[model samples]
Target: MALMDGRDQQHRPVALVTGASRSAGIAASVVLTLAQAGWDVGFTYWTPYDERMPWGADPEAVTQLSSQAVGHGARTAAIEVDLSDPHGAAGIFETVERELGPVSALVLAHCESVNSGLLDTSIESFDRHFAVNTRASWLLIREYAQRFLGAHGTGRIVSLTSDATVGNLPYGASKGALDRITLAAARELAHLGVTANAIDPGPTDTGWMTAEIKDAVLRSTPLGRLGRPQDCANLVAFLCSPGGGWINGQLLHSDGGIS
Candidate 1:
């Protein structure tokens, strides 16, 4: 079978980053960085309004993310899908393959949370979080392996995570699950030349951090600064490169030495 569109037959790898939308979102940053590194991009996005609807629907964020990719010089496709749905990841990857091409690098950056404590968190929230963070990532890696690894003989997957995993934040468990997923999947894809890894961006300044939280996080970091989406994006670009081919099954913490 021939490779897909966003995929380059010229030997340049194609990248698909999920949940790319905002200027400061890691997914968008990854798209720009990957394009600069010469890889075409595909991404998916969801909006708050879509949360009230049924699964498999497109939202406003998808349009925005797709436009940014094209603006950044990447042959881009932005699909709309509710990532919280069980079938969301698979459907999105299928679209990428059908529309963009076979993806050589996959970035699973979809994350959802309500910021509730254990007592306040409901089963609905927990399930939604896991579906987006852990299960969805697994589905993406599986698709990447089956589709690209067979033909091209090499692939890359980078999952976004947070320090909450080790720090025991409410959603930390989900990040931890992804951390384990990266390692396990890396070993499984080793023979196919597919490498899976993770990035834990601790206390990032993604417009979601309040002034007090940012100050506290910066003070605790050895580098005395919070992480930027660009910092994480730079590493992701390298991991998608030929030089990064050997870096598999590792979780890189881009938190300026903050555990």
Candidate 2:
């Protein structure tokens, strides 16, 4: 743990970030960035999701991320929960409030992504994708809205979205639903002064890209490089900040301008 800067820990705002199981993932970057930006952090991770993916789970991810947050003078809490359960969101909020404080920002980065096209996508897989990506997100936002006690204009919700439907039916369709749910919060939660927005970070290379994919992305993108986790993290931090309070109810493409 790092030395405290004499500021009251109780006064610092807390941010709850979802889908932070991988150390190299965007959620982890968001956690670190928020911590450095002076927001105490709480994040959720489900190792089973990562374990099934090509890049296996890192058992120490939570520990390492928590240590890094504390090193930046931020209080940290990490939980492993399967978001597929309808009741999971409420438990997450309860744990976060108990361990940290009322959440000021909620970053929905958790996703169930398995590649299958319209023809091959199974009914079970489609349902699971919607369960984690769409239903869970809506439930989490509802939990956040109900429990939010922060001052008006201090509440934030940012969800990560994508637009790759071809050969990826369930993931893409669920994400489309997610965008609407997140945007709805912006209008519905207006009385609470919370701002909600979704970000479509096109083709971020979080160790899932092959050399061919990398080459194609670089060639298509004007910036001529793959999107890094930090790129999305920076945007998330800003939206959680006082400066980004005005940006709400929109889906932003934070990709490196890939065409």
Candidate 3:
């Protein structure tokens, strides 16, 4: 059975995005795009550790994201969430209800730490990776399904994954798990009207990418360019909209044609 209460399903839909900081982050960009497209939004951020680090998460970043969304004519809310913990997943939904009304669309774009290469990875790293990247995502979707169900009932879940899932170390393996989980859930949720899909942003111009690395990635991509947050956001917005109802349980590569 679908998880949504019948009464809540009848209302206008709103979207909640995790890890919405920085104009270049995928979650922030998705919220902005969704707002511009007329969807109400709720997003979260992590507290920053330092004042000047350009790449770290900041709770206040959501304010800018929300402001931009609202400016686009969509009601918006921001929250502080530590998505690495399984328990925190439920709280995110609560924030959605308290701040933005009922949530019909969910975007899981936030993650804990980024790592690469097998030799550099550790067991602790493996657990940490799954905790934030795979397990938390699964739990969030579980809660979303348990709470929202039905066709025309309103529910869309788009998660951010990585190309590394195809072949790599902890990071790639973790996202591979997420992909399998999402695809299975999509199949189960489809009957009830919800859709689940994964997207890989493909080396976008975020804080983590050094200029030299960005240049290398751009050159590698078939399109001869690195991804933009908006590129991923555009696909996410469409998935959340009524028009994307047919595309479910799929892994979309928004990576500018990079493998």
Best by lDDT: 2
Off by over 4 Å in 2: 1-10
TM-score of candidate 2 on Cα atoms, chains taken together: 0.96
State each model's CA lDDT, in order: 0.73, 0.91, 0.74
Tens-digit per-residue lDDT, 84-173, candidate 2: 999898889888888888999999999999999989999999999999999999999999999999999999999999998999999999
lDDT digits (tens) for residues 106-137 of candidate 3: 89887755555767667887887788788888
**Two-way lDDT contest, 2 vs 3, winner:** 2
Candidate with the larger TM-score of 1 and 2:
2
lDDT of 1 by residue, 24-99 (tens): 5777788778876777777777656234433323344445545555555557767767776777666777777776
Report the candidate with higher TM-score, 1 versus 3.
Answer: 3
lDDT for 95 in candidate 2 is 82
Q: Given candidate 3, what's the lDDT at residue 71?
A: 73
TM-score of each: 0.86, 0.96, 0.87
